[model samples]
Target: MSSPQFSFATTAEEVATAFSNEIKGKNVLITGTSLNGIGSETARVIAKHANLVVVTGYNEARLKATEDALKKENSSANIRRLVLDLSSLAAVRKAAAEVNSYSEPIHVLIHNAAAAIGPLNLTVDNLDSQLATAHIGPFLFTKLISPKLLAAGTSGYVPRVVWVSSGAHAFATGIDFDALRKPNKEGYQAMVAYAQAKSANVLMGIEISKRSKGRVNGYSLHPGVIYTNMNQKPESIAEMQAIGILDADGKPSTEKFEWKSIPQGAATTVAAAFDPSLNATPGAYLDDSTLANDKVGAHCLDAANAKKLWEVTEEIVGEEWVF
Candidate 1:
């Protein structure tokens, strides 16, 4: 399929406006919507079009703040808050159940939250912290809410699951199944673990697209290199420099990088979720608001690996989520 002719400079608000008629009255659920983050911006833009916008975060204070910000943007906006801590499997499941209890079909599910450059650690579930927070928790949450997404299809809406993957997936060797199953401090490399989780996110989208068979569309995207709270911390900045994402002076490298504004970073995600051109192309990898033909690595597009990831994720989550 030919890539869409979208300007790389487009912002989330523009994308949302372009599709406002189509997405009006739709219900959207977005994760990791803390203040001043891409997810928050995405949710804000989406609220302009969607009937109900649910923003979630681990911190109650931040979640409330985000809801308040959205309300401020549009006082009449129907916004809800879900307290979700992706680091815990139990919390993810409970949150998913709460979303389900709303009795409203979910038209779009955006897995926009992620943990980056954090210390090596294990969750109570014994899974790698990065993997659990970034992939596993979102994977399970998606599974539980899929029925709602599928039901929305009956109304002629093209329900979507948007996985916010990163270009960093290109740096990962592959999924270390053993390490994910039993992560030890000695075996953990923070960036590598994060890369693996990002790769898994892409694979999860591919697998979900296959299983849903058109009832629900899935897409993964690299929301360009943006300076957000997730990657702007001192530790995260040091790691970015080490990985050549930034320069010694703490600025993005001009030669190979162009940092995106928060809204700009969210353009591709908004495009993937509502672009009519993508209706026939589920499981595509998008970057810079267009289909990325070659930038997505072979590993991320591996079907067999995607299936394996689906299976392993089910096992880790201790639930059979048949689509």
Candidate 2:
């Protein structure tokens, strides 16, 4: 089968309008919008088409700013902001509860928030900060939201969730079940952990799609490298630069590689979230808006491993998954 060619020269608003039309009356709860980052831009784009836009982030001020911006553009659309810190399970549960309290069914969820912890660092959960923010936190959040999504799907909402994964996910070996902490012995190892988390995201998304059959469509997409704030922090941006990950231009050198302008970076995600053709093709890894069948992203293709990761994540969260 031919893979989908995911490039788009269109503007972000055009992509947003196209995607929003797919779920015009559906509720969309987008996380990580409180920060001045890609998530905010993504939310703004979605707000243009979605009936209700729920924005969330850890910073109250940034969240408010995002909310105000969305409302300014679409005064009549229902928009709300909730401060959420995905690093803590408590916060994840609370946010999930709040989202579930809504009477409307949620149609889409985009997991775009991630932290790149370069130096060896641990969260309060004794997990690597990158792993916590990128993998564990989002994993738990998905678990918490599964019931609502399942309900929505059963209610004829055709609920869907999109995990904003990355091509760097190809670099990881797989999840380490024994060492859930993934302690980094070297600086380079930290980058490996980040890849592991990203790979896990793709796997988890695939698993959700497989498990749901055609009921709830879940997908993981690699938005081509766009310059984003997740790379701004020292531990992240500096480390990548130190390792020659960036070109002399000081930006992520996607010239020799592949990079997307913001709109192009958002293309695959929009396609996965809205394309009518993909409504039946569940559990597929999408790179640039097409199914990835090559060894290019093999780590995310392990169905058994994905099931294990799902089971372990559920055990850690101490809750039963709804879907």
Candidate 3:
């Protein structure tokens, strides 16, 4: 399981082409696949080789758009559009049920959806919106669809969960248990919440690797700094301009931060999903396109926090994951 020679500049199509054997005929489910996003690009390339590609989003119309886009990339693609709002448990259950009904093993499940860094808002389940959408909902969805992943493993296919985290996870040194339980207006900062949620995604990878007991592999990664809908907020654009990420005319620049194109941004995710080199490390955190050895923050390396988050999420979702 030697690491492949891939860099931040690699494109998703390149990785998919390189791993065409691995991606061929596999069933992949990806979340947050709206147009002009990394998830959509990842799905589009995989659809070129996959037998079934399920594109998911919170909006039905957007999911349809993603489905059409994938089909355009591969005319023979078998695409399924699923509406999944990660903020709601009910929605997660419904989506999981739809997936389970397919009777096909899910060879790869990519949690590419996330809530934006924003003001404090609680879901109907009384949890922080960011935490619920980014971690808790994906946690529950993974658990619910795990049987399909395990089924893939039983059939001699390597089933893995790819978590699309960020290097920004360095913002928080650890998970905020209190904030997850009770998100209030007091002392709430958007970046901190975003950090915790992103770190939790990495933690989920760690715990899934430990708990899955070799039946499933888990991976998390930073997809470089690709400007997508996730970071195109009005205030964020003004701030980016101040930091030289955007020029005076509000166009992207290479002055301060080096950015990636959507396909380049998706390279790590595409590699994590199909690259056999990553099989060596079950709970791997990658940056650029390979292991994030020095780049990943200390907070993301804590196995204890990963375990605790797994347990707490079970309580939040009111369903135990024993596999």
Candidate 3 runs further than 4 Å off: 1-4, 234-253
Which residue pairs show collisions in model 1? none
231, model 1: CA deviation in Å? Answer: 1.1
Once superposed on the true structure, which residue ranges of model 2 sit more than 4 Å away at CA? 1-11, 34-36, 154-157, 181-188
113-205: candidate 3 lDDT, tens digit per residue: 977655677887988888998899999999998888888885455699999998889878898887787787888877788889999988888
Please give, for residues 11-49, the per-residue lDDT of candidate 2 as tens digits.
455556655557677677777764446677777777777
Report per-prediction Cα RMSD to one decimal.
1.9, 2.8, 2.0
Per-residue lDDT over 1-323 for candidate 1, one digit per residue giving the tens place of the 0 to 100 score: 34346777889998888888767989999998998899999999999878999999999999999999999979999999999999898898899899889979999999998876866766888777789888989988988877888888965567999999999898997898878778878856789888898898788777888888778888899998887888777767877887777788877786678779999999988988888778777888889888774787788777788888888888888888776
Candidate 2: clashing pairs of residues: 4-290
TM-score of 1: 0.95
In angstroms, the error of model 1 at 194 is 1.8
Candidate 3 global TM-score: 0.94
Error of 3 at 223 (Å): 0.2
lDDT of each: 0.85, 0.72, 0.86
TM-score for each candidate, following the candidate numbering: 0.95, 0.89, 0.94
List residue ranges in candidate 1 displaced over 4 A.
Answer: 1-4, 248-255
- Looking at model 3, the pairs that clash are none
